[model samples]
Target: MTLALVEPTVDLYGAWWEAHEEWGPGLHEDGFGLAAGDEVDSPAGFTAWVERVKAEDSTCRWIVEDGQVQGGIALRHQLNEATGHIGYGVRPSARGRGLATWALGEMLNEARALGIGRVLLVCVADNEGSLRTIERNGGVLEGIRGDARRYWIELPAAGESGVLTEKGADG
Candidate 1:
């Protein structure tokens, strides 16, 4: 399994539409912020949307396994001054497999590479799984926002121990 930037193509768009049909309407990662009803139903439109994401100030990537898109992670920089915000979701079929936790680790690596020192994550207060995933990735509870919980994960410098890295006893 690998985390890859989603490429706009007919195959991917078709698969997404199929998932939408089966799972009901929700965030589609590719065209984040756009209602599912507004999602382009054409390959060309989907490609154009992807180009927009590449041309935008944020970055989004997908969790791919065996040629299937299991989930996605998106990052927005400069939020709250010196912090990047993370948004992620896993497909229902891919739930309960630790994919979100692993993906969060990878996203933090991306953040470090881009000089991001701290990341903010907000999840529904009752989302136990999501809360655990954030905690596992080193997020510390900062506070709560309405029905959401806010957490912050400070990126570690190389050689510094943090929840982002796992080591065996021999290390």
Candidate 2:
């Protein structure tokens, strides 16, 4: 499996749409808020949200396996004066193959380089796979949100680690 992060482009709109349409409803009540598309309602909202995330710093997608965009994860920077962190996620079907674990590790590797101190991730209460993925990535369960479980993974205070470099872009 090859894994690499890239920016969103028009070319991705189609696959993103298909992935979002299929996973949206089952993933959250705010289906429109979560899916990726061009409509001002569902996918548009995601685009706008992603843009905001970019403004804070940078955004990226984690593509895994055979150069296919099977799933993606974004590292959204938090600008709150009190806390500096990154947020991320992966596609639904890509859940079982340890992609999330790999993606989260890569995100944190990037975060550490970007001077981000903490990484936060949340999963729906029933998303057992996600919970396991997060735990595998060294996430510490913080608490529960309305219907989600929150976690925090602290990046090493300093020093470069061989974590992200081990996996080439072809995973």
Candidate 3:
């Protein structure tokens, strides 16, 4: 299956909604940049949200496979103490396929391109999948704050090799 990270576009509205619905109702979709007041249920609202995230201080990309939205990943240009510098999520159906790991690795390159020397990623303590994904991308456990486990990854300089060279299912 060919996978790609692409900018959010209205053309993928239906595909995005399919993945969004699988996530259920909430603003908990990491990397989606969904706000409490944003209305993504309507065409205009969705378009506006797309524009907002694209114009924001972050980079958002939808994970697409075979022309369907499988998940999302975002690299925050600014370092957020609470949320960290990167966030991502895969649709429930898309889990276990290493999509998150692949996307995170890709975003790490983006972070490096932005001249970020290091990045932080936080995931729930009990989220084994997330833990593995982060670890696979060279995340070093910093500590646990409350229920969240914080990790820091030192990015390689531009042109250096990355941790992941090809996509595969989560091992």
The candidate scoring highest on lDDT is 3
The local distance difference test score of each candidate is: 0.70, 0.60, 0.92
Best by TM-score: 3
- For candidate 3, what is the TM-score? 0.92
Collision pairs in model 2 = 1-170, 1-171, 2-170, 2-171, 3-171, 37-43, 65-171
Kindly list the per-residue Cα lDDT of model 1 for residues 82-115, writing each as its tens digit. Answer: 2238877777777789988988888788788788
> Which consecutive 10 residues in model 3 have the weakest lDDT in total?
162-171
TM-score for all models, in order of appearance: 0.79, 0.65, 0.92
Please say which candidate is ahead in TM-score: 2 or 3: 3
1-171 in candidate 3: lDDT tens per residue? Answer: 999999999999999999999999998889888889999999999999899999999999999999999998999999999989999999999999899999998999899989999999999999999999999999989999999999999887877765544446544
By TM-score, highest first, what's the ranking? Answer: 3, 1, 2
lDDT digits (tens) for residues 1-171 of candidate 2: 556665554445566566556656543422122334334235665567556434545556645455555566666566432222433455666657776677667777777888777777777779787789778888788888678787877776676463443346656
Q: Tell me the deviation in Å of residue 41 in model 3.
A: 0.8
Which runs of model 3 end up more than 4 angstroms from their true locations? 159-171
